[model samples]
Target chain A: MVIYGVALLSFCMLVGVFLGDLLGELIGVQANVGGVGIAMLLLILLSNLTSQRFSLAPMTESGIHFWSAMYIPIVVAMAARQNVVAAVSSGWMAIIAGVAAVAASFLLIPVLSKAGRGRPE
Target chain B: MSGDVLARVLTENSLIAAFVVVGALVMVSYWLSARLTRGHIHGSAVAIALGLLLAYAGGVATGGSKGLADIGVFAGIGIMGGAMFRDFAIVATAFGAELEALKKAGLVGALSVVIGVVLSFVVGALVALAFGYTDAVSVSTIGAGAATYIVGPVTGTALGASSEVVALSIAAGLTKSVLVMIGTPLVAGRIGLDNPHSAMIYGGLMGTTSGVAGGLAATDPKLVPYGAMTATFYTGVGCLLAPSVLYLVVRAVL
Candidate 1:
């Protein structure tokens, strides 16, 4: 069952990476574009569309959920690959830029929520 | 001879070794989050902080480019942390976001994605300009990173930015993610972030899924799915816009 989730994710990855590469080519870029994003969308589309039809077993579904929660470890692994020391040693430019962007975005939340206030679900 | 054989075996199965190391690291981070921060700072944020420090230590120790992955037993981290698994994990996160829940996010939830991406990009770009990173490619790549760590590298790669610039972009994105994680709970009360609607808006604006998810988990567990769903959308929006539209905007400014 767990393997099944991996199998499904593998299919999505192949198709998504291909599409992303094609998108890059279409846009004249030399790199893969939106590959992960495309893969994720495909996973969402496939799982939602198929769950009703498949009625997968409870254990199987949990296996899928378990993988979904794998976000933390995988993210840590991704972060581990980065050269943090060098990036920091270069300058404070990146640090300040990132902080400024987040601060501005955080401050905008109050204003943005105003648009949602009237349309409660 | 036995010790040498064991060492060889561990190196041969480096990915397995990486799992062991990372698993322990995550456990310690969670323990720290629970005990040290009293859950105000989520374990995910703590894990990321520890991971970055370890990467730094590894880099300094080996003077290697791949960070911790450069060491013999840790070499598997190179593949474990590569784009394939990163994307796999990211894609899987949206699996539980049933379409019905998505529809409930509504217009403001949708608007947040676009606004968040562009606003973050512009702020990052302005900082880049101010700090002497004036070129369109550098500015936009860093700007895209400010949107999210994922977006930063994607835009940098698409624009063919140098590896150092890409690294810087990623560093910037990581900082944003950590900040959002730590800051969300502290600001939740003042900003009225108790409901699903606002969580979605918050996610869109913040644009780091893990950060938003962790923060919301600390503030209110029920809102995690809503906020995470839209934060995921923000990354998608950022990936698309930062490399193309935002890059052009930066070019015009330059």
Candidate 2:
């Protein structure tokens, strides 16, 4: 049952990556264009469509949910690892950009909070 | 089986082995977070730090481009950790989010996204300039990274910036994400960051979905959905603006 869900995810991923590659080619970029985002959208669409049209087994639904939950941690770990390696080899500019972005966002909080206040709920 | 055959099999299926290693590292990172930070800092952050250390060590050991993947048996990490999976994970998070909740944030939430993207881009661009990155592509790419990690690479790829600049953008975004995860709870009360409306606004302002979600989870689990809702929009908005409007503006300035 869970395997079915993985099958669906894999199918979506395949189509999404295909389209992403196509889009990248069209746009003249040498990379996948939002492949993961497209796959996720496709999964959401298919899941919603199927749930409305036919009943899904509880196991099938849970299977999908399991993958969804595991998605973030795994992806984050991978990306963060790659990013750190890239940043280290790149230069100090990356470090400066990182530190500066954090500091800037922190400072923006007060300004944003002030603007958010006294508004009607 | 012969020893040579076994070695070949392991090398050929090394990616799976990499996954197992990464999973173990994640568990260890969580344990360290629980023991050292008392769960105050999110385990993901710790895991990332440990991952960086491992990556650095792997690079030093192998002197290869793909880090640990260059070690043969860990080659699966390259595919497992690729863009396909990265985007898949991001899109998957949206499945459980309710469309109705997005309406509650209304105009303020919309405005927050605009303000958040522009402010972050400006700050990121300024930082790029400070670092002597005068090119518009580098500046806008880093600026988009400040908007969100996803936006950074998308814009960089579209703009034809170098991979190094894109990597910098991602690092910048990750730093912001970690800080938001850590800072939200400590400043929640002082900044009046309570309730769904405030959470939506906070999410819009912060713009990092994971950071906003993690922070909201720490502040009040109830607020996670609302915050994530707006934060998701923030990513979309950033993606739309970064390569076109923001890139043009940076080009004009520099």
Candidate 3:
């Protein structure tokens, strides 16, 4: 059954990606099926790498791989526009964002740690 | 193309000498970073410094031969971060006063990452709308790719969205990649997510938002080449069989 489940999950993800293109075409949603496909491929590779020990449950890695692939290609497509990026690129922006991410990581990680206290899942 | 760039720079500028100089600096940096850590983490500063040395050496040695050295620098960065993560985790596990505290911290770290992604996207989109700007998507996409490829791709997925929401998904992706480049050693020093597989998974999560953000930023043909690979790789797994398993679990729990 586990084998069947893994096999079935693999098949469906592949088909969904291929079919997602057709669905996008039909629905006129402009979904980058190729990008989605790429996300899926990367996720599968990731799941395979990490799922051995930290896989909270069977197929957890696989499942996260599936859902995560859904949104990434869209982000990539947006990045392709060089002209637009050139107009807004700034040293300050980079500095600010870098600072912000670090600050946020420092502040939020610890806070979240505190909040999660006394709560057992 | 990257190889040619390196070769041209090396030949035209006599960069080999620079390599030796930088290699020495990197060694010193490694020693210093290690000393600074004071056993909080181990081997990271040295590893990063070594990696930097190797990068310079590798780049010079390979002379852009198949661009393997360039790729190694990126991988080395990720490996360093993974090593750091492993070190930190081990310390947390060994030294943590409460097992629950460690678990909570991990959960918090994960959630903050998620929240950060969403907020980044919101900021990105708003900036895009207000200034009538674009192009950061590529930065984010590439950033995320660098992150995931180096760390495992999951981290890229998680942080990718932060860039997307703010319309800097590509930058975010690239940032993650750079972070992997720089942070790997630091993270490795303090904690060790020593497992490459786990690192890759984390990389994927980091890249995910970047992918989404990249797609949202534009509908460009050129971006897809860089942007789509990570998305396709991660989502392809989903298409294969992963989602259904998730569905079953949700169903069972519900």
Candidate 4:
């Protein structure tokens, strides 16, 4: 079940990454350009448009949907590789100040969420 | 062959070894997620925390700039954790969402994105002022960094902030991203972030695309799109504000 789902995701990823890289090279950013977003669009297309043609099992469909949505292991990989030390060594003040700033933003989530409630237009 | 030869072999074929190392870490993280936190916390959160801890420690131990990726055996981490893979994972989330569901976010969702940008910027500016970055460029660059890493550079370039300051801003943004990723699931239940509306708000407020998506993924795979969609808006708003209106405000303040 997951195999087919992964195949679909992987197919999207390869094409997305390639196009993103090409776009980046064209734009001179030396990085992938909107590959993830492009791949996401492709995935949404396939998941929605081709579902009828494929007739995948419900578990397979959900499995594709599940990993498509979150997939935290990759997040961990990205987070783990960040150069926190380099950032820290640049300025202890920056790290401390940045933490305080982000913490404040975190605290404000509830206020914003509440302020936004009880209205539908 | 001896252990030396075995070590050399592993070092030479480091990509597979890196995957092995990461697989082991994820495996352990999930087990701890189940055993220690009883799955109240997702393995991704635990794994990210452990990753930060390990990377910080490893960076200090070797005094290397790239953290764990500096090690030969762990070198493939640069590829595994780099932007390409990160974006790849992020894009896949598109599959989970329905366009029609966006209607549910409504006006409040739009307001959240706008407010979330200013909210993060103001907090970052205040903190920057509190610290020793008394100059407008330094203060605003760091402040913009708090909005998101991308905004930091965009603002810095527009303001002509020194590259060192821009680097610091990037660092600041990276820190925020990690914080959001780890913090989301821990506070999701208490904050009533289970549904798509709240998820959109959370994404707007957090405004770091990767962090929001990752956190929401761990919390609820279905909610990733809502959070990421607004978080994308938040980035756009941050980019627009931090360089122009926000920069002028900082100049006036400092």
Candidate 5:
């Protein structure tokens, strides 16, 4: 039951995201990715609420299993793309970009900290 | 060549191979993560890995160049899938929790998170307009959840544009890095010794939404710069991290 629950949730969320994307395209209103995110989030909330109202055990955490396992095949394939990655010569750019970004993140963290400072009370 | 091997793999028995390979990898990651993290592994990672595998298999079988572009595209789309998948999980899990009377009130609790996502998008969109960047939907997902999956691929797509995707992705990475760096501090300020991480998370969510909203809103076609900046800032940190992330994978091959 737990396993099925998690699977059901995942499937629903996937459908929601896909649907949201399609909706955005069809409506031409441009809700952005948040539409899908919000949709899935709402679905999860709804599913959990409905299940509880009926008294069911929480869904299994199998999606985590499914998610973690995906990397192996990707890494393996990327391993196969070594030569293409090598020829790019853009490695330096990536490095520079990475360093700069990291540095920016470091700087931004404190600024955000300062900016976010407040208590509703 | 690897491509030839993939071709053979596909021609001989592609569907079976894909199933077996993906299933095995999923199990392996599950086992490893469960064993190491004690079942704490994230579903997003698994989804990403699956997306990459599927993309690669499809690309290779179809004779697409096994180049950065193909892989990057795979990664971008995978990120999109992964992000949505996680959102689904979060919502589902929350719902499951509510159903079983595990914790938190049902609708109200769920609404809190939904509200967060919406507010994040509004802020992200405004910020993008102020900064000047592209108005792609991928940018909208930045702050939503597990946007890393979308960020890389978005950058890949940006490369195909006249603006250059790598640069854009790298820019996105930089933005994330900045968000993370400043996010900690920013949240600290607002929450007042509360969970600083949450603030950063919210910021990221907002940043990405801002990008997407801004991008779509910038239909004039001249607001590309604003859209790009908005998009990059939202996913900047993730994009910047792409090189090293990909480098590590490439390094393993060597």
Candidate 6:
């Protein structure tokens, strides 16, 4: 039952990656175009569809949860490493952009807070 | 099998081995965060710092283009860290969200996302300008990064920005994520960031899902779901806006 969930996930990923690659080619870019995002969207749709049509076994449900929990940490670790390598080699502009974004976001807090105050809840 | 055969097997499975190594590193990072920062700083931030340090070291040691992947054993990192997993994680997070709760945020949540994306893009573009990046693609890509790290590369790639600029955009997003993780708890009380409504608004205003998730977890664990729900939409809104509307705006300005 758990294996079914994984199979489903894998299926979604395959299609998603294919579409992403196709999108990239069509756009004249040499990279995958939101392949993972596409896969996840597919998964969400399929899972919701399946759940409504037929209840998932608890084991299958748990299997999905296990993978989902692992997803963020593993992805973050991998992405962060790649980003650092890219930033270090890209000269000072990257660092400046990063710092500026963070600083500006901090400045925005006051403005956002003030704007948010109108809502009573 | 002989020792040579065993070595060859290990080399062939280097990618799996790399995952193990990364997992260990994550544990160490969490331990360091707990011990050193007393958990004030999220473990994700620490893990990222350590990851960056390792990446730099790997790059220096091998002089290879793929960072640690240049080394024989770490080559799997290239695949593991690729967009496939990144997008999968993002999409999977959405599966658990309840749609009805999202509707509860209503007009305010939608407004926050619009305002948040535009404001962040403007700030990012200004930073790009300040750094002598005069081109619209580069400026908009970086601005999108301010929207969220996910948006940065997506916009950059779509607009044909140099890989270096795209990388810079990611760095910009990462920096914002780390800061939000550390700053949210400190400012939570003062800014009235305690309730679910406020958390949803906060998530909309701050488009970085990881940052918002980590920050909310620190501030109030209960609010994590609410914050992450709207934060997910923020990314979607950003992805839609960055390359289209915001890019057009930047192009028109320059």
Highest DockQ against the true fold, candidate:
1
Model 6, residue B52: what's the lDDT? 53
Q: Taking the tens digit of each residue's C-alpha lDDT, what string does model 6 give over A6-98? A: 677778778977886787667554445545546655776787778888977888776666666765455444533443454445656655665
Show how many residue pairs clash in every candidate, following the order shown: 0, 2, 126, 0, 65, 1
lDDT (tens digit, per residue) of candidate 1 on B1-254? 99999889989998888788889888998999899989767776677667767777888999987778777778888887776666566566666665655566657887998999999898888888888887899989989988888888989988999998898888888777656756777788888788777877888899786567546644665566567656755766677788988898778878
Tell me the spans in candidate 2 whose CA falls farther than 4 Å from its real position: A7-55, A89-91, A106-121, B1-7, B42-44, B63-66, B106-113, B131-244, B247-254
Distance from true location, Cα of B218 in model 2, Å? 9.8
Tell me each candidate's TM-score: 0.77, 0.68, 0.34, 0.81, 0.41, 0.69
Write down the TM-score for model 1.
Answer: 0.77
Among all windows of ten consecutive residues in candidate 3 chain B, which has the lowest summed lDDT?
Answer: B87-96
Q: Model 2 reaches what TM-score against the true structure?
A: 0.68
Q: How accurate is candidate 6 locally (lDDT)?
A: 0.69
Q: Rank the candidates by DockQ, best first.
A: 1, 4, 2, 6, 5, 3
List where candidate 3 sits over 4 angstroms from the true fold.
A1-99, A118-121, B1-41, B49-113, B123-171, B180-254
Model 6 per-residue lDDT tens digits across residues B1-254? 59878567657997687677778877887899899999976676566556556766777887754556566767677766554554454454555655555555656666777888888888888878988889999999999987778889989988999988887788778667656765677777766787766777787788776677557655665565556555655666677788988899889999
Better of 1 and 5 by lDDT: 1
For each candidate, what is chain B's TM-score? 0.71, 0.65, 0.32, 0.86, 0.32, 0.66
The candidate scoring highest on TM-score is 4
Question: What fraction of the reference structure's interface contacts does model 3 contain?
Answer: 0.07
lDDT (Cα atoms) of all candidates against the true structure: 0.75, 0.68, 0.33, 0.73, 0.36, 0.69
Candidate 1 CAPRI category: medium
Better of 3 and 4 by lDDT: 4
Candidate 5: residue A40 Cα off by (Å): 3.5
Give the Å shift of residue B251 in candidate 1. Answer: 5.4
Residue lDDT tens for model 5, A6-116: 566566556655665565456342334334444434554555465567744433444433432332333333322222222123343333333333333233434444433
lDDT of 3 at B88: 21
Model 1 chain B — which ten-residue stretch has the worst lDDT?
Answer: B213-222
Candidate 6: Cα lDDT at B12: 94
Indicate the residue-level lDDT of B51 in model 3. 40
